[model samples]
Target: MTDEISHPITMDKRVDLALAGAVVATGLLAIWMAHDFRIGKFPDPLTSRGVPYIAGGALVAGGALLAFRRLSGWRDLPGHLTVSEGTEDEAGHPASSLRAFAIMACAFVWAALLVPAGYLIATPLCLCGMMWAMRVRAPLRLIGFPVGFTLITWVIFAQMLNVLLPLGPLAPLARRLGLMY
Candidate 1:
């Protein structure tokens, strides 16, 4: 019997791949711009460019993997089933490009405003806005998502990672919470 292949990517899949590539490329570009490209001699036995080089290489590899999986016959290689028509239960939903755009926009705005508003305020606001925009209508989740995410992010980055996020107006409150202890 002859085997047939079908398109592995829906419109949503294509959008996802493009977004991933854009993000990875942006990170790689940032690393390239911030550090010297030359691997100079170092007392620690590693150059300043070492970390960036590894990050850039990983970014490239990730983007290539996504692109290759989307555009090649790799989907059909090895164990695979023949193409078939969609059944009633297998109907696909329309891709929500608008939601994707909104989510990305929210993230950008959050990052841009983080230093100004502080992590405590900006993070919760961002999470709530993003969740609502993504059509999460449950009352509990609408409230819980932002609060939970903000607390977790604060604990992880501020407490554990030792990264100083802007405290803004919430500095007093955070101090009162005795987070430092």
Candidate 2:
């Protein structure tokens, strides 16, 4: 005789539901806030409110999709995977949770350093540190990801969007590096 206990629900599904609920709520709030917006005298057909409304609508639609998938049990998970009971390791040494803590610390450090060092310097350091902590094997990727992220953020904020980013004491250095004006 074989007895099997089945759990009708999964933690993954619960997480999805929670995320969906939050996103939907946030979208609704965005839409509500958007209603109060008024573009002045000579407003374009696409006003300041247009992008926010579109983004909020997209978020709402995505949240609805996630909620529907969870309710319908249409999960894109592998069937071969099985959950193992207990938390003890084979060698009896507890696995380190410090890695997660380290990542969070790195993010906090990056945020703290952002204004002083600017995003160009702080972001790449954070990305490299995170990749190292995560034990990424590809050496090229270790260098590439950080540099790519920094360049993209720089381009988007400083050039394309024309948003002023503080260069801190390195304003001249950044200008010499041809990244900032």
Candidate 3:
């Protein structure tokens, strides 16, 4: 016989329950806030409240499923949920919480800069920063992907949807290029 230790319920397993609880709480909060939104004067099929309700409902459903799976000791949970912190990613790099923190910081900075710096300037920088934090080293991909994605989104919002986007200091250049009317 060999010496062995067994942990029927580990701290890592508890983490799933904690995360599920947080998600459920957030969803409930979102639904409550969305319920308070004033109805627009114009009668639109999809109001401002529609998207939030849908998102909140989805969150609640997903969290409930996750919690149920954990409580029932389901063996077929997703790989990411089972993988503990500091585990090696598919690329062989040890996943770092520092990288996650960096990405969050980048997102906060992007939101702070959005109105002043404009979407074109702010979004690419945020995407590049996030990619860098995730260990993307290729110069072409680092530069091209963010720029391309931003431009595509800008066209969709500004031109297709007829939604106004801040041009910031690029207002004159945009007008000259006929990007804005």
Q: Please, what is the whole-model Cα lDDT of each candidate in the order they appear?
A: 0.73, 0.78, 0.85
Which tens-of-lDDT digit does each residue in 1-181 have in candidate 3? 9885542332466677899989998898889999999889999886989988989999999999989977776464533344343423668677799999999999999999888998899999999999999999999999999999999999999989989998778878999999888
Compare the candidates by TM-score and give the number of the best one: 3
**TM-score (C-alpha) between model 1 and the true structure:** 0.59
For candidate 2, what is the total of clashing residue pairs? 0
Q: Superposing all C-alpha atoms, what RMSD in Å does each candidate have to the true structure?
A: 7.1, 7.9, 5.8
Using lDDT as the yardstick, the better of models 1 and 2 is 2
Number of backbone clashes in candidate 1: 0
**Model 1 clashing residue pairs (backbone):** none
Q: What does the lDDT come to for candidate 1?
A: 0.73
* Better by lDDT, candidate 3 or 1: 3
Whole-structure CA lDDT of model 3? 0.85
Candidate 2, residues 1-181, lDDT tens digits: the string is 8897654333555666788989988888898898889876785886878877988898899999878866666445444222332444568555657878878988999999889988778888898888887877697899898989888988888889988877667798878997677
All candidates in order of TM-score, best leading: 3, 1, 2
Q: Where does model 2 exceed 4 Å of error?
A: 1-18, 34-44, 68-112, 137-163, 174-181
